[model samples]
Every structure is written in structure tokens, then in C-alpha cells.
Target: MRRVRQLAERTPADRERYVDLLRAVAITAVVLGHWTVAVVGYDAAGRPTGRSALPDLPWAYPLTWVAQVMPVFFVVGGFANAASLAARRARGGDAADWLLDRSARLVRPTTVLVLVLAAGALVARLAGVDPSTTRTVVWFATVPLWFLAAYLLVVPLTPLTYALHRRYGLAVPVVMAALVGLGDLARSTDHAGLALGNYLFGWLAVHQLGYVWYDARRKVGARFPPARGVGWTLLLGGLTVLVLLTTVGPYPVSMLNVPGEPLDNAAPPSLALLVLTITQLGLIMVLREPAERWLRRPGPWQAVIAVNAVVLTVFLWHLSAAILLVGGLDAVGLLPTPPVGSPAWLAWRVPWLLMLAVVLAALVAIFGPVEARAGRHRLPVKDAAPDGADRPSDARHQRHPLRAGLAVAGFVAVGAALVMNAVTPREAAEPLGLPVPALLAYLAGAGVLRVLRERPDTRGPTPPASPR
Candidate 1:
């Protein structure tokens, strides 16, 4: 509590608190939603089997639409990325320097997660556990990284995309939307190979909206009348499109991909999801005023900062906590897992979620500092006195060609590895050798980035920095 209070107090008065609030809310929803729907049970032989529990309820599909918060995350990411890039540019920073700064904060904590997963997989393999079980567990564990992979790929392109935002404004997202529509068409025709670009297009479009939000706010202030009513229209229009797509267009109503179902609204996000993003963006714009006012209070702002501090840790490990609890209890025959969608199961969700929260809190405590320490090194204020002037990080004014080249290679390797891993087949948590190449690539990238030239910049993230 003291630490949180201190964070609040330390925050610059001019900082935008609401962005952090949005990020916290979005991630919280994701964590809770996972706990709510994840159906972990035992097979006839007593091995763990899991899938989304939504189908059992029969009435929960519509709720999943409300619960799906991934779009909000990308929107927040876009805003932060645009702001961070602006700040970097204000102080003579280059594209590489800005990307390096952003990547380090993200990659460092992810390394810890990947390594932990690797060790767990190795242990499971040594136990003579079914390779299939191990493979399934590993794949399920890696599920969350899909977001990281896509976000990481997007980070490198901020310079280009931000340029498009500058040159074309709203047209950028609209064009991206059209491409998403095309991707959906290819998907409908079973041209899965050709539809791969939609993943990039879908997320980029949400992110582009953030750029729109940031630009509009800067230009017109948050109270702009035009932005407010867009929310209601988006809410209704998106809901209508969602209904038609599910009922009339072959897309699933559930935003999340349910196991045993052929439709996945998320994996290669469909056009319906784009409407959902528009709706989320609308809500965000409409709520900005009240949300910003509420966040201005010291206590609320402090909570937001504290949550953002360990947000990555919370995101990376929440599912791991749930998995451990479920697997451990099931192994000992102490788990009281009710039949899927049963009344008892519905009643048990409260305690189940509470237990997961407790465990996740502990995991955050253990791993969160890794991210916080790295964040403290963001670029410095553009100007400062020379007599022991405050510098943002411990960076020295030096550059290494070898280090820069290695950084390029490292990023490429990481991107390729994450993509390969995501597409690779894994049935029973058994991956060939427990090696996580992406973790290595990220570490390599971070080490190289650390050696790149560091410049001073206090233009800090539109004052409302969130992970992009």
C-alpha cells in the first residue's frame, strides 16, 4: 500500500491517468474471463482435459461478447505507441532507439515467463508423463503469447503506421478494415493461407483507432461532441453485425474460440471482430471524460500506476496459476470440479476464481519486479542541468555496429520463432526438447538494445503510457 501510494505521489501531475485505467480494466477482464470459462476436468484415465465451459451454460455466448476485452487492449496499445513515438521524436531519437526502448520493457519480463514454461515442460517430460499431455499443457500455456507475438511485430512498424496516421487519418483504419473484410472472404472460401494477413490487419486497425483517439483528443479535447455519440451507434451497429454474422454469415457468436467448435472469432480475427473494435473504441471515447475525472483522484490514480507496474507479470502468469492449482488438486484427487455447466459448478465459480486470484497475486509478487526495474529505464527528459543532471537510465553514449546487427537478427529470429511456435502442432504438452527459442531471441534483442545509443526525452507517453 505504501509503495502504491508512493507511485501515485511520484507520478507527474500532467500525466494522463485514464490510459492506465483502461489498460488495467482490460487486462483484469481477460484474467477473470479466462478463469470463468476455462473448463478443466479429468478424462476417464484421470489425465487433465480442458476446454471453454461456455457451451454448457447455453445462455453465455452473448456474455462472451461483453467479456472479450482484447480489442480494448490493442486500442490502448495504439495510443501508447503513438505517444511514446512522439515523445521519442521530440528529443532527436531515431526509430531504432525508440523501438529498442519499448522492446526491452516488454521482452525482459517475457523471458522470465518463457524460461519458467520451459523448465516446467522439462520436468514433466522427465516424469514420464504422456508426451501428449505434456504437449497439450505446453500449447495451452503458450496460448497467451499470441498477443505478445502480434504486439511485438506491430511495435517495429509504429514508425510506418504512425506515418500513415499522419498522412491519411481515419482512412488508414478504414482501408485496414477493408483488408480485414477481404481476409474474412478468403477464410469463408477456405483459403486459410491467404487470410493470414488479417491478423496483422485486424489488430493494426484497432491500434489505428487509438491513434485517432490520441490525435483527436490533442486537437479537440476529450469533450468533443462528435466522438461521444459514435459510441451508441457503434454499440448498436456492432451488435447487429455480430448477430447477422453468427446467424446469417457463418461466424460464431462467441468472441472466443470454444474448443470442439470450428469457428474461432479471435485466432484469425474475423470482420465481425472489427465491428466489435469500433464499438469498444466508441465506449472508450464516450467514457473518457468521466474516467479521466475519476482517475484524477490520488487514490484511484495510485491504484492504476501500481497495477500497470506489474501488469505484464499478471498477464503472463495468471493462467499458469490456474493450471497449477487445477493440475495439482486433480493429481491428488482433492479437486471438487463439478460437471461442466452444472448448478454446483456455477456456484463454485466464486471460490474457484478467488483461489486463482490469490495464487496469481503470489506469482505477481515473485515476478513483477523484473518488469518494474526495466521500466524505470525509459528515456530521460530532453533537457536537464549538467551538474548531476537527472538521466532517465544508466545508458552510456556509445554504439556498437556488431551489437546493432545482432539486434536485427535477434528480432527477426524472435518473430519467426513465435509465429512458428503458434502454428506448430502440439497435442499433449510434449514439445520435442523443451527449448523456447523465442525467449532466447528476446534476451538477445534486449542485450543488443542495451548497447544502442541512449538519448534524453521526458516527453513520456502522452502521459498515459500503457503496454502496446
Candidate 2:
């Protein structure tokens, strides 16, 4: 707590408080949204069955548009990654160095959770738990990795994408969004599943928009970052497009994946999702100044810093915490089995949220240091030699471009594998009973990235000279 407060106090006045605030809010909403929408019950055979209540609750569809904050995350990511890359590049850093620094924070928290999950799966299966039950529970627990996977894939490509943004300016996003639309069009035809490319294209487009945001801030005054009324335009325009697409087109209105739904707006990220994201980004931009002002208060700012300090850990472990709470409660008959959307079920949401929060809090306390270490890794050096200590030269620090490419390929494989496994779980057990191939991919890819971290100083990131 003291360290959190001290770190908050040291926050630069020029910092973009709104960015961190948005990130904190977005992830929190996702955790809460997941807890609220899931409806779990037991079948006639006494196996626990879990399903999303989205398709059943028609009124809940619109709520997803608001609740699905993945768009916001990508945008913020664009904003941050752009800043980080520029800073590193100015220091003569290469893509590999930038990727190493960015991904190191992700590595620690992710590894701890993945190992624990693999062990948990092994234990469950060895205890004679039904294969389906163990699979469902473990699958749900690791579902949070999807965001990490996607974000990891994007982080390494910032050099390439940001360059595209610089050369083509706004044309980049226009083309990217167009590709998403084409993918969606192809998805609607006999080749219903042909839009796989949009998964990368759609997210990269949203992320590119973040670069647009950052660039906008750089040109205009950061104090009033977004152009006036841009938010209004996006909100109205995106809302209209979303309505038209869902009603007149093949895309479903719900932003979340619905069980048994033929076409989800968010599965591969359709054109409609990009439109909705414009609305979200506009809303975020419009509120930037006000949010920044609110964040200036020490009380509020400290809370934001504290959350950001361990945000990755909180996000990665949230589902596992919920899974533990739900499964444990169910095993003891403490978990209620009310029909989803019933009055009783609605009433139970408060307690369910409270319990999930409690368990997640415990998880964060235990594993959050892994994430906290990442932030401190970027802090300026407090101690140095009298004559100013030297560090690795730019050339030595830069991984050979080809080697960097291979490293990136590894991370991309991890991310793509995660999305595949999460959407389509494998029923078979592994050598140690690790059920998901994505988990193995994630661990293996991370290992490759780490070994490639062969920088002169392997503690991780090179500390910024000014702590900027």
C-alpha cells in the first residue's frame, strides 16, 4: 500500500490519467460482465453445466455493446504502444528490445496462472472427475487468456503497424475496416467461416485508431486531446451503423458470443464491431478531459495507479477466481441453481459479484507481485555510478531482424493457438493432463521470447533517462 501510494505520488503531471482510468474501467467491466451473464446448473446426470445467458435474455444484448470493452482495450493499447515504441526508438532501440520490454510484464503473471491451472486440471482428472466437467471448468478458468493472446500478437507488430499508420495516416484504418467488412461479407455466404482474417485485421484496425488518437493528441494540445464533438459524431454514427447492420444485415446485435448463435458480431469481429468501437472511442475521447481532471485528485489517482499496477494480474486471474468460487460453492451445494433470468437469479447477482470480487482479490494479493514487478522494471535508475553507469549499446541490444521475426512468430502462434483452443476445446489430456494445446503454446512461446531476451541487461526493460 505504501509503495502504491508512493508510486502514485511520483506520477508525472504530464501523464495521461484518462488512459489508465479507461483501462482500469474497461477490465473491471469485463470481469463483472462475465460474472453476471454466466448461468451454471447441473444436468440430470449431475454434471455441472454452464452457459452464457446472452441468447436467452434478449434485453441483455444492448448491454453487451456497452459492456464489451475489448475495443477500448485495443484503442488504449494503441495509444500506449505508440508512445512506448516512439520512446524506445528515439533511444535507438529495435523491435525485439521493444517487444521484450512490453511482453516481460505479461510473462510473469501469465506463467504463474498457467502453471497453477495445468496442475488444477491434472488434479481434477486424476480425482476421477468427469472428463466433460473437468474440461468445462478448466476451459472457463483459462478463458481470460484470449485477451492476453490477442494483445501479445499485436504488441510485437507495433513497429510494422505504427509505420503503416505514419505512412498512410488515416487511410490505414479505412483500409483495415474495409477488410473487416469484406471478411464479414464472405462469412455470410457459403463460406460462412471464411472471416478468420478479420480477427487480426479487426483488432489491428481498432489498435490503429489508438495511434490516430495518440497522433491527434500530439498535434493538438494534450490538455484538450480529442477534437471537440468527435465523440458525438462517433457515438451517433456508430450507433446507426450498428442498428442497420444487426437488423438489415446478417450480423447479430449482441456484441458477445452467444451459444449456438450462427453469427456473433464479436466472434471474428465483424464490420459492425468496428463501427461500435468507433462509438466507444469517440465516447472515450469526449470524456478525456473530464476524466483526466477527476483523476488528478490524489485519492482517485492513487486508486487508479494501484489498479494499473496489477491490472494484468487482475485480468488474467479474474476468471480463475470466479471458477474457483463457483465450482467450490457448487460442490458444497452453496451455489444457487435458480433458472437464469428468473427473479431469484437476478437477485443473486449482487452476492455473486461480491463473492467473485472477494476471491479475485485474494488471487491478486497472491500473484499480483508478478505484475507489479513489471511496472517497476521501467522505473528510472535510482542508483548509478558517480560518472554515470554505461549500458548495452543499441546494436548489441537489437535482436537480428530475422531472429526478431521468428520470436514474433512464436508469440503469434501462442495467441492464435489460444483463440483456437478457447473456442474449440480439446477433450484429450496431455502428458501432465494439460488439456488445452493453447496453454502449451502460450508457455512455449513465452519461453522463446525470454531466451531471446538475451539483452546485455536481462533484468528486462532499460530504464528511461527521465522516467518519461
Best by lDDT: 2
The sequence of per-residue lDDT tens digits that candidate 1 reaches over residues 422-444 is: 77676634443233464455456
lDDT of each: 0.71, 0.75
**Against the true structure, what is each candidate's TM-score?**
0.86, 0.90
> Ten-residue segment with the worst summed lDDT in candidate 2?
381-390
Model 2 compared with the native: what TM-score? 0.90
Which tens-of-lDDT digit does each residue in 1-468 have in candidate 2? 787778777765556667778889999998889889889788787756667888789888888889989999999889788766665655555666667777667676777877887787678778886666666666777778777777877788888898898889889989989999888888778575678888789999999988876666554344324564877787788888888988997778789998777777776888888988988877876777677778888899888878888888888888788778877997888878898889999999999899889999999999998888766734322211111112234554465667677668767766765676666653444433344566667777878777776543443455453221
